[model samples]
Target: MKKIEYGMDFVARNLGIFKCPVCGRSFEKIVHKSVSCDQGHLFDFSKKGTLYFLKHGVKSDYNDETMWQARRNVLQAGLFQPIVDEISSFLSENRSLRIIDAGCGEGSTLKYFENKRESNKDIYVGFDISKRAINLATQGEGSAFFCIADLAQLPFAANSFDAIIDMFSPSAYGEFERILKKGGILFKVIPNENYLIELRHMLYEKNDNHYSYSNAEVLSLFKQHYPQARVKRINYEFTLKETSFEDLLYMTPLHWGAAETKIDDALATGLAKITVDVLLLMVEND
Candidate 1:
């Protein structure tokens, strides 16, 4: 079909950026919309408009349609535009950059960089272990390419990217070090203590244990991998609409352990605004 061909065309043109997720080897050829490696591992771009590179069990806890849809709606509402702007500004100097968004759910966060560019010089590849997430990600047109793949073992060749972005996602430092060229950056975002404070406060009693968040352990782990990594906190508040009450609850992990009763109460008594507190980590592979 035309859709499949369009997806194939992209792989054929930029074949240098991909590798076999199974063998971790560069492709030998890309013919008839299929990429074949030296060892004979071949993968084809799907008719569903995504590339298939996940060799192992492709399952994710974050693969819920309702949750991803709520996330998409919240992002579209400009609640996290400030963080997007910060990332875009950080990479503005690179006219042509090869970027990857690890654990990219629905792909809006990665698409922000592509849309901000004056030209389509940036190559943005975003992948999540969730098939449902990647399916929704590929539905849009942009500088981004989506796939259902694991982060622990990335499917790209060594030194293939200029930067890897992990927004509110898990970090794979070992895999990250392998794929990034020297001087490349790993742009990661983690929550600050006050992130979604309104929700936490409403869900728990005053000064509850869940209300406390410390980045000390996270920072220590980052330093253990990249000693030169720098951290910056982007903190602010976004006014919430009563209509976004449900979407906000679904978009965050804060409700993953909450009871239905608590969730309903928060929905009924929603905050007019919530804080967007996050820490951005910048680490050069070198």
Candidate 2:
């Protein structure tokens, strides 16, 4: 556990009808007002306190609690501290910022940021498609608000967030642009070529094909929608303990190809070090 910030209380208390999902306008209050934009596109808030603005739907495979628990254990072991530190550094100066982890898994990253910057008191919101993950996140004593929702169609009004994070998860650029406040930053983390070479080598007995993308390519894509954006890169290496071998396998999307027998063998083989390459981009909504 981490200490909850008092500034979170301020954001929660002043919470009202947020951004306009269609036009990206900020509204002071939302009431009998059927949320409509200048283009006549309309949205409605659900009774459960979430607004539905997405037209199409997206699905996810991380619906299992077992997988989330395994991922949490590995993350909590400090294997991904570098990435956490990078995220925290970007958020250190802000006070009472409205932050959302769009694809927050098991809430470890969100919790870590909240714990590290206890004085900032930012309102941390974690959203995932998996109900199990959100449920587990809420159980932890923190200032985080957990929601079960899809990123393709975010539940918040347009320009509602001060900052939004999408770490190694599917991102909806349109949805991100809609939710982020003007001049607000959206930080996205994507894995580099050698993110988990050790685990891939042990499980496949060969090199796993990594998803490679150039910073320019990603920047071009964001620039198409948002012309003013900057990209930052963070790279690090971490040593994995024997105890975390199984957890690492289970938590990764690579687990489908990993056999139980192979995992057990790796656990017995002892600790290994792996490199992590992450791309963090700060995109301003145009």
Candidate 3:
């Protein structure tokens, strides 16, 4: 089936989970290739098999196709497999699950879980604000659904998901709480100091602020929200292949604001390995 047709069918099967972005009413099955609520809020699935739930388009540095492709390649290289493994273990608790990857760029992480599914009953939904990222995520359309959605205003209904994964993305804790089911898990990943330290040093050699990184504020904020949250520090170094190193430079936000000349200069420094230091915060709804 065409991607658009497949997406419409998928959305039809999971229509109960969706709520209208405007009216807050539940969405019904696909009609005329679009899903609409009683109040007349209609959304069409894109040709690439994803839905856009934004009233106004949002601009982000991660919206570029090159950046998303780089991210997918780097992730598939197994650099972030440890983190994926950690989350996957928790997901195994339930025989059937409904998972939402909040801010899932290119859907690489969701694709990992989809591949590991033991049955077709598991529901994997990945949403990002980037259209290009969601477009790329629809390549195979095996068992995952992709959407362009806002974190603060999720299109899914209250208590819709079994787990929510927020990896290196901004957290809309209130929205997360609303959409996640009772006793659901929230896996939040934040970068720690020394995460890509080589690139930081090369890019901002003279600027002390840019060269130094910290997760103190993020940690404090998360603790405030979930005091009993379980935290794990994942620190390691990944030996980079030449191609992987190039993808790293393109994928990371560290190089987002850096000039092309500066990036070229950083590339000249020569990095064989990069630090993958991050904290995984796990909290369960009571």
Which model scores highest in TM-score?
3
Which whole-number lDDT from 0 to 100 does residue 258 have in model 1? 76
Off by over 4 Å in 3: none
Model 2, poorest ten-residue lDDT window?
1-10
**Stretches of candidate 1 above 4 Å error?**
92-94, 206-209
Write candidate 1's Cα lDDT for 1-286 as tens digits: 3667766766777778878878777887776767788998878778766876777665556878998888888887778889878877777464588888888989888777777774848888888888888888877667577887777878888888988888888888889888888878889888888888889877776656776677788878887887877888899988876338789889877787777888889988877888999988898777
lDDT of 3 by residue, 1-286 (tens): 8888878888998888899998899996677878999888889877887888998978887778998898889888877888888888877654789999998988889888777665646888999998888888888546788999988789999999989999999999999999999989999999998888888887775565777898999999999999999999989988777346778888888887677887997677667888899999999987
TM-score between candidate 3 and the true structure: 0.95
> Which candidate do you rate higher for TM-score, 1 or 2?
1
Question: Best candidate per lDDT, number?
Answer: 3
**Model 2 off-target regions past 4 Å?**
1-60, 92-94, 205-228, 241-243, 259-261
Which sequence of candidate numbers ranks them by lDDT, best first? Answer: 3, 1, 2
The CA lDDT at 158 in model 3 is 94
Q: Which 10 consecutive positions of candidate 3 have the poorest summed lDDT? A: 112-121
Point out the higher-scoring one by lDDT: 1 or 2: 1
TM-score of 2: 0.75
